[model samples]
Target: MKRMIFFSAVLGIGAVSACGGGGGSSAQPIAIDFAPLGIPNTDQEHVSYKVTDKLIVTYSDGSKKEFPLSYEVLLQSGDQMGSYKWGQLLDVNAQPMSNIAYTKGEISWNPDANSLIKTSDGKYFIITHFEEPPGMLYASELDPNTLKVKSITPIDFSSVGGTIINCAGSQTPWNTHLGGEEDYDLNSIYSVSAGGKNPAYVQCTKDSNGYFTGNDVNGKSNYFCGYVGGVQRYLKDLNIDPSNGYLGDKFNLYNYGYIVEVAYTNGKWDVAKHYITGKYTPEMAVVMPDRKTLYMSDDGDYKGLYKLVLNQPQNGFNKNWCGTLYAAKVKQLSDQNGGTFDVSWIELGKACDSEVKAIIDKKPLLTDIFDVEDPSACPTDQGFKLITEDRINECLRLKVGQYRSSKFASDDEVKKAAAFLETRKYAAYLGASIEFRKGEGLAYDPDNNVLYYAITEIGGSMADGKGDINLPNNMCGAVYRLVLDQNYNAYKMEGIVIGKPINRDPNDPDYQKYGQKWACHPDYVANPDNLKYIGYNTLLIGEDTSYHINNMVWAYNVKTGKLTRIAWVPTGAEVTGVFAHGLVGNNYTMTLNIQHPFVDTFRNADGNPVNSTYNDQNKDKRKGILGIIKGIPAGLLKLTH
Candidate 1:
């Protein structure tokens, strides 16, 4: 739900003109009020998208005011295994149980992921999303009876201050919460655009330690708008309008972009940062059966997969932080979308927070972490000290999965580079493959001993040049399955589900005529992301794409290889975070955040109109929607043309 979606991020600026017209914000003021469309009743509480939460707003006088704030729900859905679904909206109040709900009101926005935690002692849920963590592990307790928020209390991480840029996360097997800090600007030198989703997939005209000179189609440097970085307080360069109050967060910079572990046990909560996790633009982490070995996915294009191997496993992620972080080196046996590949892990570095902290305190320059140079390649008398911008940039050419093992002989140098400072670059130096694009969510099927990774897009110009998944004209998206063995080692990684793109030209009049068939919507799925394994080898994929009319959650029966549409959001909205959090018998509860639903007159992430609705165009502008669907009976969902 909390996607660092590279292209989506670029479009999030809403006002910018990019690959297409839709996605970003419009410059004009609000002129039209809207309502939920296609629903049977206007009296439905779920259809009203207003919020009453008081937000801390600041004025030019340096004074602050409490204003009623509303949010656009981007991703929503909680645990979906309970008898009756119970839903909660970030801004709106709605029941967790329901089949159909209209996202109305633009009051609340960007609610990320919801997880239903049901226990013999009690039933509860946890939610996470955008730049709003008031504490490291804080929670506003809801009444045990009324379920209304009563008061908030900090859980953990009070020492290092609370977390920032808390993006998407995954629930652990041990009843803990894992949220990754996915701030794209961490390195100063951004590989992505300012606030963009996955930089690897999007067409970035600029990347730098110097001035970005690339021009938009209009011949203007979008970099001037605080898009590129790699210098001191680089955000100052983006040229965001001060009056629009569009300046970036200084907290937006450092101490973010890590995997945060929150433990909820004994009616209490605790938090910690796994410094050894080896940071990148992280999406989510999936722990294996041993609990000591884990795999993590980064959100950007051309990014590599990572692993954490604890020296010893703790009951929970206690104060313990010592571990070894490894970057994956993939051996592609085939060039197909679901090709089988041999996998290897390269040891990056090992340490607790103190060791990492010391290096930061002494030599915190961006390149200082990997301060060692290959003396063999040295210029006679000089030894390698600090890497330069050009030097790191050269790493993009290394062979995938070849890290630290052979080509690079400096053990200590590999230690620092692969472990700290600049991780993604270091992995590239070791030759770890960075081919995955827009890697979003992680799901582990213990029953099947296989894991799922969603590559949101495979083709288009985004897949051009070297790293193309090249499925002919494939554009929608694809999901890869990593089948693990007895030791949780990935033995087979192949494409399991492929999204078929509607190949017809958009301008063609018959485009709408074929819209009713599965070929148009994808017989299996489209632009798949955020996979949740809901037992019985079934995977629930939460979707996002400007390519499709509406983003939906598709149920894929692994055993049967059947794809079914279970639920979808309003136009301009993405049905994300199909969480199986609350699981009890045939019924389940999933809290879903309906994000960025545009009004009939409004636009989407790509800056396109909600297209007047495939269901009905008379509807009003879509508001932030938070609702739950109960008894999502598995298999094919009946569709209408």
Candidate 2:
């Protein structure tokens, strides 16, 4: 086993020289080394959670200490070890909440993001986010010593509408949980081109005459009605009927895609969505040390990288969600590796939550914001611009004068509403680069004044040899480091780590030698999704990829550029909820989850199907796991501050 070493200087410590020549001299710097786990490439190894790493700490006085790296399975999917079962749905009052029969069973087992928080009153809680159509959040009170779940209660979002597709999140500097909603539903609602209707949209928007109206086969009128269908389905899943015309009475498309914050105060939990962050499908939102600047990753192809700078910086973000949203326009500096770029901010207007929410209340459709025309019939002689957004090409002109409805007070109001409601389209209309593919997770390093952003894949518009981002296709993806200035604005981005692509043919010589058949090298990171900067020059990266047979969790030393495999998940399972909780009690701990095991399939080098050996207590392959790697020494994770 190859060992990884961490160095730290012993300050203000002097010792007599061994040669007895000098009276006193500064002691040598101490080094802490650890053995890393091996890569899992074989059948048996692919279906197991393996962590064979150990930490050895050496002192300048010739003394040494060693601690074995071990993980504890805190909660597994479907485990009824607490008041509420792991991943189980519960109402705000701790009562069981029902779901539709088809999705009820599946939503109870998918756990994505985990935020371990310590309150000012010396209480500890873990906030877990469930990724589903109508996403949910659950808070569990933990016994600080044993780290066991004492009680569990689901955080209600009924007041702030409802959150969907809750994915990766981060803990705020103000000691609150900030979660994300990956709202792909926006893609279906705003699709306007012919033959571009989503099947789910077709099924959801039946007219009053009991016929599908907003479908590609039929004339595409009322395409926004598809969003109503999604809300109706979510309500039905919650065992609530929408026969009372709840779709028209409530529910808005702009309400779902913002960052949600969950804070506990006065013995109650409060939830609020940051609408000022600009609505989009966010994978994760991470705040800089300044507590006002935020970087959010948009999780799909041809999406834009967003940044929000809160107006009232001293008051903090949670207190005031009002901010200015900006999109990144990149200039490719180099095409080598995964590519590097010079980043410039494109101001995408400014608005508060109240201002944007008032516009959403009017229920403005796509046509209300812009006059849409077919791509071929675009009137270039007029003021129409041909733009492609969400894979649909259309000619759009901002609605002004008497061209739009009487809902807006002025044309300025219409533009302000479009800035927040149709964020990606408006950014594109303003000439901002909206061509990033699979932007996943974000991590900030306060000491270094830099931010690390993860790109799961480098294909799609990113590699199309046009526009702002033009690079070679590397489906294995890469991680880019952005250099931040004093004001928390990023000026340059460089690829620090890039994955290696390999031949997936089972009969290939490389596949036979590596004992695996996958699209990416098993040793390097494939589709790096969730990231956690655990101080001491280390960043933990979790994989969410089908390209790699067995997904892995790696610890990369940013200073030394050393990548070490720390853990592995079962076949077809993604390593999610990768959080580094520093110095919980006497030990440093990290939380990670295995989500949706066996949901995908893998093949061996011999072209034989490989199945997972992971059998939870329920003997089901569809379950997930929420675990913690405990006993990490404080010496291995000393903060730079």
Candidate 3:
């Protein structure tokens, strides 16, 4: 999470002396440590709050202050869905759709990201995204004092044709929420066929122009092949009927996979999809201080690391959707400790959002851009290049000359469309390294001119020792630190915090004593997902993994090279939406969400549910939580060493 640092006037560094018992002499910096959470007992299943229940602050004068450390639950998923303001699907006339299920059973309980927006009038609203097939976003008015929900208003995405799998997001520098759509449907866009899942949904066949010939594709009984099928499901969930004509005649795959900006204006929420930000399964897009440059993390196996630089820096990124897209091609420096790399950018293409959106509006098929053939049958003599993208080996050749569409005047125009529309495949064709596995979260440290990128796991093509990324399999994952240049472009990367893999056998000598049955070390972070930069030397990491019984949130001090566990979730839950909202009063607060608890599907060695004990202890198995950890002293956040 990227946030603007807030320094309290009352608790500034100058006030340290006043906090030191009003002494005339200056006080030394206070020493602070968050007591780490211990490993859960063998039979333990619920959340373990073994970490000290207090924030201990020791002054140079030997005086100590202990503030209670507790999590304040702001909203629960089940509770929100059961409320009146939970929101319902709207029709073409903007009226709530009737007979639609709005209960907890009908809606998803997975809360992924939270962006707290403070309006100019001192009003606070948190935009939360639910990770579901048909994703949902809601604006909850938060009480400034307690950071609790006062009212909930569902943000309508019907204007942008709705979104699917809304994942991790960041609060933009312009004070709006920038969300991502994790559209994995693109991976199978060329493979899945019409009526593959349900024959009753088959409507019409594609014409020679690649457009639907008959019936409304958004209709309940209408189904299209590839990416369109995914969009059909999303529309169906929204209760959109064929007769209503809600994107029923013209549905495009490119519209669904991009960065979405949501802003509260004049007491209403407005949304826009930024087509210029390329298309991929984006986990989060972190904007640099320049505001025009963005580093977006692609969340999938064999994906590319994307960067977008908006042309009009004076107007900032939100002004217009015109940018130059680039992907990283990394040369491995070493394979030790999750590997190090020398990173260089490969310019994909440049175009405005409207230009690409116009091409997308045509509803072109995958074959319209490139000729794709199986790797084994690739005709190298015919200029086909063998490339691995999305872990699929394919022979691809960009179309040219007479093969080009008349709508696009030049080959450059078609290339630009291909660059933004089929980003991953196009990057591979352009020779950009696309072997990253499970790229998760991104955080920029402007003070150090560094960017922190988290790779949730290391496997697949990344460890095959045949591609750009050749490393040992480390399912435990690692957080990489990228050194950026004056232009905010990452040039070098190395693993800063790497998880240690251990024996998983219960009979192992270390298993009984240290609870090392998990694949990764229990004391350290595994599958680091959401990251929040706190202070000058601390980075907060949240986990989303099955390596450990309980997902944890850890604080790693960059200066000290120490990793301390700050919090953990109930069994089978991910620690997500980790945001460090700077000083609130005299104390600092950080927001976190526990997603999908007590729903462990991963099994233990004995073939029993890994969180069976937890399920037995807890009654509700599908509720998620939005909470905050308060009582952190402002002084702690000012630590430079």
Candidate 4:
């Protein structure tokens, strides 16, 4: 009965009329016992050490302190892993150490704080990387009256080599730090810029795609690393063969998605590709206050949302490259299974002519197209794998709204509105399937232009509500927001509902004529009276290699739209357990990211703290992890909405 009214309002803990619904069998009374909104992480470092826990140290009594050991604590203790030579952080008794100054117990552990930005002189750097094997990208400096983490500066993924995997970046229009690159035969796009005035270590090239020949050098391509002031590099083209316009194209190497514009002012490092794509895994790349349009976020598997319209016009650092890519049309698909949720949209001119004719015929290889449901493998051993159709059309591209219909019509209905995109099926039911519920982070609030998403869990909640995992919890993950109907603000799609609509009286007997698509309740308690609950969103509940709720993003309020919460940095701290994420920076320091931590906190094998309890009977538990409250600021996030 509406899952017994969402388990009597999430096991009655977060109670509020137990959220309504389950009021029948003589109203099933007495069974209350609630009280869980904090405390239970038990803290002790979620047990034993190393493999993945991606760094987290947030305290102020929302309580959290866990460090699961990494790089085996600089090789199990006698610490000193330096050698940046000229960019600093030196040692072996040589000196030059304000970058990572330790000293109290330098042997055990304490290097868990993965990505946090704010440079340009406002200083707040904070990037970490080390699950061992030379994976270094340290750089700390915080304190602001006890925010702790005083000084650190490591930087060494083998001086920007291969196994550094992925690291979303952004802070340039000429300030430094760009970093980019992730898989696709060993991606590339680095430039820490150390101390500017021409700092070096560049990489990016492809006029002939031998995949850059295992890091070739003598032909001028050991992936460059030298030329910052002249801007001679900013790599990652992957394999672009979209019918050759040339810049290298092994059948467009699945267009390897977007973000390419390496500018370092007159001295060197001026690469290109700034933005151009067919969609799918464009990864992070942000630039809009008209820095000539570019706003990406597609960690593939059709998680949706994108942008890149600049073929001309320029601003900020000036580097424009051809453009015209826009994806995001699901129009409706929110079902929940009590059987009535709503929003079945999908037409954007037949989903951009079936994603530019599937990236212009062929080029799909992300481990062999579709089927990514891995609740821990073996439904016959996990499906929809990838090695490349450019990682299966960059995992089904999506940006949001209007799948088709609106060229201002007329002209006699423009060839039946382009042959009504051949009776659409919503990008083939989200590209043949995979919603094992895992679509992390994605925010765009410019003051309530509304677009906050974070699906962690939406099925288990009732042993009196606080962290209940009883089963039958399908409706997958939750935390949604899609409002845009201020009278259809230029029709990106109208009043996308989220609550308030259980009006039944069409002459009784359960009428239901398309007017009921959920919203009568899901914890959206009427505010401007249209269903709300956008605060610190959630959904990842318990076990799956160890408790979850990876990368999450949200920041809205363009004149009172409210919804803040963006402080993510997980993926088992870069062990790559998924939740990929995007949106980098430029224009004097920008931030909203996640990547790298290889381990420093996250436990289970009985050690507890995989965000409290979790499954596997507690797998070596060591508990302690849960902190929220740090959202709103970017000068109130770009003014007007």
Candidate 5:
């Protein structure tokens, strides 16, 4: 019956009642149809392109002009297949700098928080590297006026303590950078020399006896990247052992998964983990207008969209890290590919900073004298130190609430263990929806109190029998939006836009023969990753696709319901790090990255060269940055929610 209601609203395109339940039948009604967003993305050149059809956006009207972008390359990586002398570098006054550093790829423009000492006399930027030894976060200062690099320095995370494979982050209203690592939930970095002025990390393979060994480097053992039994995911993932701390073993595993707020407040860039925001496979964080409320996304299986309300809004994360975390449970009101629905938040747990710190303090000693090779010790010994025991099981034994059993003394212990430790599991046991995949990038409209998020894959959570949803499986992906109550809690949740696979041929491997199996467009926007809202209810969708698509960035107007392709990258790459510069005005510069493109010039199957992406100016062909500044159409500026 609920499925029928959702289908009536979504697939049938029925309207949702204020009561927030499906009352209509699941039949496609002959309703209004909007034109397609934009034409297929052109090559990665700074030229004007056309929209697919006569793009008539409701808000911007059919007359909105598409402007050409004038870009600037701040810094490039120096990896083996790198370009330039080592890609490229520009000094403070836009002058070319001679001294070069490492190949730091996924980039973010900084000065997130005003620092006392200038790393560079101009603007500050940070970049991250994946799969590289001693994964690092580098700061490059650029002249504000000319936007050129003045100096470059590696940020030492030891003071804050953690060997972070620094990934994507969001610039907070506090002027801080809250960076989140992918696939790094519950992983620990415990080597004393992990992340410091000069850091050393271990890369190791585990033994059957619950121990990890790394190659000898300079007479010292390399650090372990995974917990004793925790999975060692990938290059940029959390691989360090939990017994090993991030900066030191006692520094702990609970330290890594939460948002690491990197701020420049008292002269230097400092990092502090905000554990109040229940940890998961974190991707991005969006602060509501109230500042006290935050919307965070998790990019992992069984991940759920989360919201947090701080005890004090005026007191920033550095001082006050006490808050209540909630996971959204959607009651599907619609069933369209990009339909609408109501959402209710399930309170998972609450925490204070000091309490979480104590958990981290015990991380190193989370041990039990368990016999090795005891098959019965599997789940029980996972999180403990045998080397490491399954502390997760110990925590499980302390469960309370609906999941409580003979293992726990009270619900407080269960909440405490699950609050900072097994966040996802804790939420799931509370009946919070844990059926999402790749939920990343968040944007919100304060005036309307609506939050928009990207669900990169249209499977798992949306599968049959979960929520009783009956919408078509979008092989491409979709953007979901939630309308929040005044308290910044979700009252409704639903899809707004869906991805459709394009440009298919019988010869293509992705072609679904009987139309049963399918893949999205390889050159179009699919598997939407990062999202940025540029006023007037316009949401930008960036891609991190697996469909072999030369990923692209798109703009979806909430008012007009149009998905326009604005930017694109080359083969073997994902469109990452889309941030709208904080400059106030009608028109502003949007910073973007063409991350990790193919080192060599790519060619199509017909032996034709793919020229637009390759930069002939630099020999090595490395990743680069772009700045896109376009005018907001007149209609868009005067529009309101």
Candidate 6:
């Protein structure tokens, strides 16, 4: 299972404190060898803890600190969850209670609506804690009143023969949990029924080997073929060799960069049809207000946005996920040519059908892909080569739905494509001294309808220890917000502030008005006049203080977009990103994993899959859940509330 924790990019170097004391008084820092923690030490893995019975910490220095179970903590958590709660820290038979697994994990709450669903079945809200993508998923089902796990059930995703990496707790139209994965190989979505089994739901695919197919006629990439380490190179290296190539024949991986659904009745998974075909990859599935349509992001080569429309109704409560795919294209005005370019909005209705096809074959132009001023441009230097709409319509008319071209195109085609791509525009240009890590742990605020993402500062060479207060090339991260215009027509970094400067181009009209230049290296967001910089990572905003734990991007709300750090975790407990589980009572959840330099995913212009490879791998760390059950005590916060 390829765990997709994006936080490893935030590698902060701090003093290694000791694991102080034991379960009674507040334990001081003490020593703890990570090797024994059983956590995956890769940049993609993490170690999570629930403040239960006691606060347990195995420090890097080989000592242990167990904070005694505190009733006060439990009470506090209860207040936050809307009631007082308690549970048995011990297992059903009265054991030490240690069956927690860690991988790419998330923390979620069961809202009133979801709680009603669970209560009808005799279960209450559970602040699920588990390792994402790698470890066995386990949730602490605690009572909102007592703040305890009424029961301890493993959030299992083993059916598809894979692990759960980074997952988004999708609030289904039917009001269930659609836990997704960062597993590019075995990408499956699981559902947690109201009153179901331990896992509650099963894989969405019918069989273990989930079904996926790209809708273009050029075929797919190696990412789809399920090549072990091939995804990393196929994406970053940018060019795919069609024949006699080392990575494989071509980039068939695109064929597999699709979504799947978990079935509860039968232990199986059913893959969904492709939403957006060329030059894009889908991550974080958020259903639009319309309920039937889903807004997805491009974790692929295109680095854009998209939406998934359910062409067919979800089979009632049966959990069916068959839908039509549509890529997002934003409509923006271009100052250079006095033209309006749509960035990430999909052309709707029949108007899109023909254009979509032609864009697939004729290949879209790459003039300005990421110019902040030109919302439609990313970079004119390198962009995708999409086929035109006419050709796409022709293929559709012929009932041709697959791309059969060689994995890698011919040399002549490559040369022509490369030249055209070189002139492509960029949505946000990083230049030689700048770079932007792909955003991760993305979530939308229903209340505000704003999109949040984290950008890791992992790659790019660092200078000597001059600027390094602790380690060289430290992962000084940034979090960014994609504020949807009132019309929700597009999202931009305009008027967004990060660090010192407001992310505005001086030449643009809004630049001087905002009085900011140079956006953060990774991501940023603007709320009114005050702009807040979110490190490239997952984020959680609380009432008072903000938290920047390791890879976790936890922050406190300053009413609007302003942000401040309240808590931070250094290494071992690296948080990749954060997600707000609306079903889980809107309680926030963050994912953690090991720290590494190269942890990422990429897709070809044709929507092929790719991954990042790291040289020095951490050995001990694994994946697990990190739950922040606000307003509760420690002891009562047990397996069974």
TM-score of each: 0.64, 0.85, 0.84, 0.24, 0.66, 0.42
Q: On a 0 to 100 scale, what is the lDDT of residue 451 in model 6?
A: 57
> Which residue pairs show collisions in model 2?
none
Residue lDDT tens for model 4, 344-405: 23222322223333332343222112222322221433222221121221111111123222
TM-score of candidate 5 against the unseen true structure: 0.66
Of candidate 6, the 10-residue stretch with the lowest lDDT total is 390-399
Off by over 4 Å in 6: 1-119, 125-146, 150-169, 183-256, 260-281, 300-302, 311-319, 330-344, 347-437, 453-560, 580-628, 632-641
Query: Candidate 4 versus the native: TM-score?
Result: 0.24
On a 0 to 100 scale, what is the lDDT of residue 13 in model 3?
14
Candidate 2 C-alpha lDDT tens digits along 135-164: 777776766666666776778887776677
Give the Cα-based TM-score of candidate 1 against the true structure: 0.64
- Top TM-score: which candidate number? 2
Full-model lDDT, candidate 4 = 0.26
RMSD per candidate (Å) reads 16.4, 7.0, 6.6, 24.7, 12.4, 18.2
In angstroms, the error of model 6 at 449 is 3.9
lDDT of 5 by residue, 1-641 (tens): 00000000000001121121122332222111223333233444312212122222221122222222234344444422212222222222222333111223222221111111223223444333222212244454444444445555555455444433344566666555666644343332123322331122233444454333332333333433333222121111233443244323223455556666665555566667777776566776767767688887877555777788888773343744788888877666667765566677888778886776665555422111111222234344443221111112112232334545433355675466565555665565566766676787777766467887887877655654454344556657788878777777778777777776643565655453312212454334577876766564567677766453345667676887866665555454455555434322222233454454543233333323453343354324443433333332222222111
lDDT of 5 at 459: 67
The prediction achieving the highest lDDT against the true structure is 2
lDDT tens per residue, model 3, 1-641 = 11000000010111122244312244443555667776665555344322235655565777766556655556555454334334233333334433222113334556777776777676777677776545677777766565556887777787777776678888777778888887765442333232232122233334343433333345332322323433444454323222222234435556776888888777688888888788888887888878788988888788989999988652323525788999999999999988999999999999887888777777655556766665677798988788877666767678767777665678987898778888988998988999999898898876687899999988887898786889999878999999999989999989989886665567866555544336567877788998878654678898887777777888888768899887777676777776525433344445576676765543432334456666567645455655555555555554211
Question: How many residue pairs clash (N, CA or C atoms closer than 3 angstroms) in each of the candidate models, in the order given?
Answer: 63, 0, 0, 99, 47, 189
Q: lDDT tens digits, residues 451-564, model 6?
A: 554333322311122111111232333334556655443444221213222323557543444222112211222111101122222134211001111222334242344343
Q: Which candidate do you rate higher for lDDT, 4 or 5?
A: 5
Worst lDDT run of 10 residues, candidate 2, spans 1-10
Which wins on TM-score, candidate 3 or candidate 4? 3
